[model samples]
Target: MTRTTAADVRRDITARYRARTAKSRARHAEALRYLPGGETRGATRISPYPTYMTAGEGAWLRDVDGNRYLDLLNNYTSLVHGHAPPGIVEQAADQLLRGTALGTVAPPQVSLARQIVERVPGIDMLRFTNSGTEATMMMMRAARAYSGRDIIVKIDGGYHGSHDFVEISVGAEAEAGLEPKARLESRGVPSSVLQSALVAPFNDLERMAALLEAHHERVAGIIVEPMPNTGGMIPPAPGYLAGLRELTDRYGVLLLFDEIVTLRLAPGGFQQIAGVLPDLTALGKIIGGGFPVGAFGGRREIMAQFDPAQHDQALFHSGTFNGNSITMVAGEEALRRLDAAAIARINGLGERLAAGINALFAALGIRAQCLGYGSLQQIQWTDAPVVNLGDARRAAQDTGDLHALLQAELLNRGVYSSNRGMFSVTTPLQESELDLALAALKGALQTLLPYMREVAPRLLR
Candidate 1:
């Protein structure tokens, strides 16, 4: 009997992936000439090249190689209604016929803005942008303008976006201290950008309060994700969001919630559920109806920074495609369709998926946990409580290889998900689809256990 090492399992998986995705490989090779690493987005890049998708619909994607997959990635949780819902497509097409970019305030844009202002608890007024990165960037700028402060506090491992300021300390190596240093995520991000931002741990209210207290005077705002999707789908501890609200109020520093991912958690977003409101909220993803969009808004006084009436003191905010007709109509349709019932259905599936995976890991004697809220979930490979980014980082480091192997195996089995172990349940996902995904995950774990035993004996319970 041959004892298969971790490397052997990975080799087999890579071979299978390559054989099934030859067209994807060729396309990637051609793409590499124009795009760096053969992709525009960094997260979609997989080792041995990535699968090239030709089309997607109703929670399924068809690859260029003609292989079909259950799309759990859902465009990084942007596709709440799954790929190109009939309504969204029709709405977008209608808008395209009317005008894609009218270069004026379209009626659909105003209508959608009104809906958002009425729904989201934190937004009184909002300005749209091209992406979530722009939303967060503008939020920070508005915060600085309102507070007349230069420094901003951000959560370690919380992925706001790729913009210069928020690009600090996201999934950086954990330091051996209470106060974490702000490490630059990208090379071109200036050191001065890092200097302007203070990094704090997610879910650590006491430590965050202390750090904020020390830097209260210079701090403009504290930006955070209500439920951090990137840092292993770590949810805030009970009363954590409330504590942050209190701290921000006490210190006179603005609170900014990056609800780009967590907005799908509730009609009014995580803030509505948690009963904690931010001074400014950054939104994107699902709100765009699967199109590219972003928005930031807050209290009337704070959001006045973008008011054209006060030109002298106003923080200049404008984009070529901001509130374009296509995105605005599409977003309106998406939000109109995403009711409480739909949210509940998808979230329920997510809970079931998480529970099923956790039960499987426990039964198989694997030291791992599935953690998330609402429709989002991730498999953290360590038993340690994910109280902060440091804990999550340590846990990931301990089982990085095994986690990668699990992702590859799941992909080979027709389930597509993020390599970082994150997956979302789309509105179109059915109970049967969820069952199949869980079954695939269970099979992946069972098949990979021998390799786990070879590489990580201590992981066995």
Candidate 2:
């Protein structure tokens, strides 16, 4: 008898997907007329044409093809309470009528700023921006002004946001060590970004210290995601964050925590959980209550550089929609509801899902592991510890086929997630949704057995 192959299984899955998502195919074809790659952003693009979503409610999303998914990705971990949350939507609507952008700071904005300063350990004062990208950009500028330095250190493959400076060393070649080679990853970014950047690997204290020891004189700040959300959701190694604090203090360099995605992990972000505070914090995602928003705050002295009272030395910082009423009220509602209890519940669910995923992998006798912290999880096809971005890339290189199969199969069963093996649990998610996801995984694995046995036996025990 003839044996099946992974390619054959993939072809079958693609055909089925194309058949079911006919309307989406037509929609994408129409989209090709105006949008590049039939989508506005790179993250939302999916293989065999992206599924055009029409509506979302709570934890469920409806595609243009009229298919409903459990929404595991949750708009890339932005929606903690899921879509169209009643209270948040109501407040946003009310603010819309009053004024979206009134050109002055509203009481709602002041309330949010005070609320965050009270809750977060590091933030003493803050300013709002339109997106996380803008937040990181301003935070870096503040650090530079505070330290009177030029260079900034970042992690290899750690995604801060899409800007010229951060575009450096992202997706660089994985090499022998954690030090970044400083390869420019994006096209439009100037080569000068490499000069202003120093790169190090996550979870490695000694290497990090070495990088700081050499460049501490010229370094402004070390910007990091407390629990790097896009870098495979890897958690900090024990004492790693505290060690960063110590080193920054030793060198007199500021530390900036990019808590855009990791903020959902705890009440006051991973910093509070780890008991290590940075000089500045970049905030976004869940804080916006599903609106477009970002904020950067730090010690009052550092933040005062933007104050008009600074006279000639003041940095000119202003945005048309900086403290817009709609985003302010919506974000306040989101934060007000996201108490310690809600954080604990969602984090508990994340743990449960991680354990269950690992168990499933073990039962199938596959060399895979689920890695993450709190409410985030990543399916790495390697049993090797994914302590850094290099390891994540290795898994992607070796098991690209496996990753595609898993996502395609899951989507076939009314589940939705990132094409890159990421999963997150939201506050609106139910245990039943998790059960459905697990079942889909089981079926997908079972279906792939024949193909795995034939083509990718290395994945098998």
Q: Using lDDT, give the best candidate's number.
A: 1
TM-score of each: 0.97, 0.97
Residue 152 CA error for candidate 1 (Å)?
A: 0.6
Instruction: Indicate the TM-score of model 1.
Output: 0.97
Candidate 2 lDDT tens digits, 317-393: 77888878898999999999989998998898888888988998899998888999878988887787888887777
lDDT of 1 by residue, 238-307 (tens): 9999999999999999999999999998899999999998999999998889889999999999998777
Range of the 10 consecutive residues with the lowest summed lDDT in candidate 1: 171-180
Number of clashing pairs per prediction, in order: 0, 0
**True lDDT of residue 395, candidate 1:** 71
What is candidate 1's local distance difference test score?
A: 0.88
Residue 245, model 1, lDDT:
96
Candidate 2 regions with alpha-carbon error over 4 angstroms = none
Worst 10 residues of 2 by lDDT: 172-181
